[model samples]
Target: MEANRVDHLLLHFFVIVVGLTAILGKLIELPADQLVAWRTLAAAVVMGLVFYRVRFFRQPRKVILSYLGAGGVLGLHWLALYGAIKVSNVTVAVAGLSSAALFTALVEPVITGRRHSKLEVAIGGVVMIGLGLIVGFASEFGLGLVLGVTSALLAAIFPSMNKRFVDQGGNPLVITFHEMVGAFVVCAAVVLGRGEPVHMPTASDWLWLGVLVVLCTVFAFWMHTWLLRRMSAYTAALALSFEPVYAMVLAALFFGEHKMFSPWFYLGVVIIVLANWCYPVARKRQAMRQSAE
Candidate 1:
């Protein structure tokens, strides 16, 4: 972590930004799909400029197309996430989104042709237990819960695909640019199909969307891609586990009345987060023991 200190800081910062993205999204008051379209478009332009300036934009055409596919999935992921918030409250949305790690645990091995680590599986189970407490005991049974779970599932697919895409030498900025553009395209189609009025933002709305694009999406995506280059998928996922916890805190600050939960809420979230944190450590020890044997 020390050797890659910059990467670590960036990853944590990315999580913080990602956590607050929901709060910012809520403030915009646009339909989930429309909001995401604008976000994708804004983020794409920001990332495109970065890619163009940095000389890191080069990638093969096939790889670029692969990233476009990944971006399509990403577009869906954002919709599901925002939809979860619209259908339910942030607590349920955050809880459901927390399951991304669980999905990654199951998907990484199958997608990457690697055997599932026992430690990752065990830790993932514990996190699920914590989430179950958040859901079954603390949250109401409702459509929000269902949407949240769906959001998690969508969240899982894109990141896993991203790991694979990058592993195949895909350019991170290019991939992000293509993906954001793809998301924007898909979102535009969706908005058109529904005949929804695309609300032009007021002053405050523009300010919030600016934060969403610059801090949350652009900077966060750059950090995420940078981390992917420096860290193992499990390490990255473990770090990402902190995101929902951060989101919950931000949710409390912004939407306090709506987000207030029982004491069990914090306890349960802590358990889930700690379990995720332990996964990398546990995996390291296991590998060390096998080597010693």
Candidate 2:
């Protein structure tokens, strides 16, 4: 098989791995804040071993502080994600998170100061209709959907922030470690402030959390970046957008979550995913039309 083909397969595999985060969040019996605290702490400790030899931490204090602040965003992002799952099922949570692809269209330009693409704005209209269907029909999960969309909005900002660090000659691994440490600090503080002890993971929770830390976060991030190196920017972005679809499919398989939704809810999901998948093709065609003209 061709190398790009192999990369494509690996890319989807990583998407599947990311799909697991929502599932594990549902399985683990902990509050969202503590779960994030534990996840960030474990991830930071593991990344610390990798960081001990490399001095990416040697970047200027200003940049280090910025990544740490950004880590707070990452921590909040996960908190919202898990919160969505705890309040609703994984299907609704991922459906809400699906809006992230559209939110990226809105968020990225504002962050990067690039002019908005008319095509993306048009795509957002379609996504909004899908979201309306979700909101109107699955209204019971309204809070969860709101948090999921909030998570999506935060997800949109994360990469643009990381890109600045990468441009500043900081390695991704080091940047991630700093973010993890930052997130752990924020999450731990929140956990402590709640007047509850930092809850230890149950044996079953530990099992799920282990899979989460090992496969969903670390391995998924490594494989995603590795696949990006081998594929075009467009292919990589497109591959990542399919994550919601994969997550929904996994939810159905694992939890029979499909039975809980009305037809309109599924219709909304289809619309969002289709709009996401269509954006790249639409952009490419518009580029071709402009070039030919």
Candidate 3:
């Protein structure tokens, strides 16, 4: 039980790290594509150096290919996330990303060939209502919300794909490394094909990007993978529900993001966050009832 509590705390810490991505995204001056490209490359290089002894290519060709594919999805997810932040404030983008659970509820059944859970769908509907409220009232951030939602959808896909690879005995770190490489490749190609002259990042930009690559991407991700083994999935899900909350709080404190939104926007954010937190509790209760029966 004590171990569980420690894991829970660690999980929350990692979620906060995840939340910081939005702040970092907004702080960086690079275009979304370039930001993602450099971030991924830096992370890949770091992970490659740290796990230098691992034989990354020893995995089956099919597994390596799967990681590469998932990596592409992961790359797209970062692009969409930063793109949202570029167009909108951190609060709007983070709020939209919070809808990942709703997307997962809808996508998981189809991917796993399981019957859709009515309760899950109902909860997802509530989240949709919340998102609708945001879109309706915060019309200025409509495009950012759209991009954020796209990012959430891609977030759902890559995790689902990663689970398959992990279940096949693939090393999580190696998979992450390849995925970073994949993201770098895709983003680099997109940036190059745009035919825009690339402006080099200033020294300050490199400092922020380094923090993002090391702390937010590599360290946080590694902690998440480690904690999942020690805590209940319910615990992790509950902790993650607070990511947008953390982001909003940080935004308000640092960037004054709260001043940019109407009261109704906060209401919508509350609703989405409540739905995220409640779904896990609801699932736990349902599981208990099933076991009792």
Candidate 4:
């Protein structure tokens, strides 16, 4: 029981760190593609150093290639997220991420070849309703909302893909490292193809990027993969639903994102948050009744 409590605490902390990605994405004055490229490169370099002794080559070629593909998708996910932030404000970008839970519900079963949970589908519907409300109020940020939703879809895909690889006995850290490499390669190609010069970061940008790569990407992602070994992906998705809450509060505090939305928009956010919070409880009760029967 005590261990469970500690794990939950750590999980929330992980979400908080993940929440800061948007803030860092906004603070770094680079295009989304370039930012993702550099961040992934930094993470790959750090992770490589940390796990230098591990023989990643010993892994089958198939596994290595899978991680690379997933990493490419993950890079696209980050690009969409930062792109949203650049086109809109932090609040809209983060709020749109809340839709990831809905996407996961829709995508996971398809990927895993499992039956879809009716309750999850219903909950996803509720989440979509909430998102529709937010988008309705913030129509000016339409492009941002679309990009953010696209990121959510990719977010669902990569994690579900990772879960499959991990089930096949892939080391979480190694998968993460390779994924970073894949992201770096893909982003670099995209940036170069666009005819964009890679801009060097200022000292302050370096500091922020360091925090983002080390704390947010590396640590948070490692912890997420670790936790997935013990918990259902549904539980993890529920917890991640709070990420928008954390990001929104931080954005308000740091970037004055509070002024960007109306009370109705906040109402929509509250509805989405409440649905996530209640889902686990509802699932637990259903399980209890099934056991009793």
Indicate which candidate wins on lDDT: 4
Question: Clashing pairs in model 2?
Answer: none
The TM-scores of all predictions, comma-separated, are: 0.91, 0.90, 0.91, 0.96
Once fitted onto the true fold, the runs of candidate 4 whose alpha carbons sit more than 4 angstroms away are 1-3
For candidate 2, what is the lDDT? 0.76
The residue-level lDDT of candidate 2 at 132 comes to 81
Off by over 4 Å in 1: 1-6, 50-59, 138-141, 257-259
Candidate 1 per-residue lDDT over residues 196-266, each given as its tens digit: 67787788878999999988888777668767777656666767778778887778777883345777766
Query: Candidate 4 clashing pairs?
Result: none
How close to the true structure is residue 126 of candidate 2, measured as C-alpha lDDT? 83
Itemize residue pairs with steric clashes in candidate 1.
none
If ranked by lDDT, best first, what sequence of candidates would result? 4, 3, 1, 2
lDDT tens per residue, model 2, 1-293: 12465776787788778888988998999899999898888887776765578775678899889989888888988888889999888877777776665666676667656678778768877877887888888888899999988987777676556545554556667777888888889888888888886678999999998889878876676565445445433344445556677887888899888888899887887887788678768977999999999
- Tens-place lDDT per residue, model 4, 1-293, is 12276787888898899999999998999899999999999999998888899776678888899999999999999989999999997889877888888888888888766678888888878888889899999999999999988988888888778767766778889889989999999999999999977899889889999999999999989888877666656556768778888999999999998997899898888989999877878888888999999
RMSD of 2: 3.0
CA deviation > 4 Å runs, candidate 2: 1-10, 223-241
lDDT of each: 0.78, 0.76, 0.79, 0.86
Error of 2 at 27 (Å): 1.2
lDDT agreement of model 4 with the native = 0.86
* Position 45, candidate 1: lDDT: 80
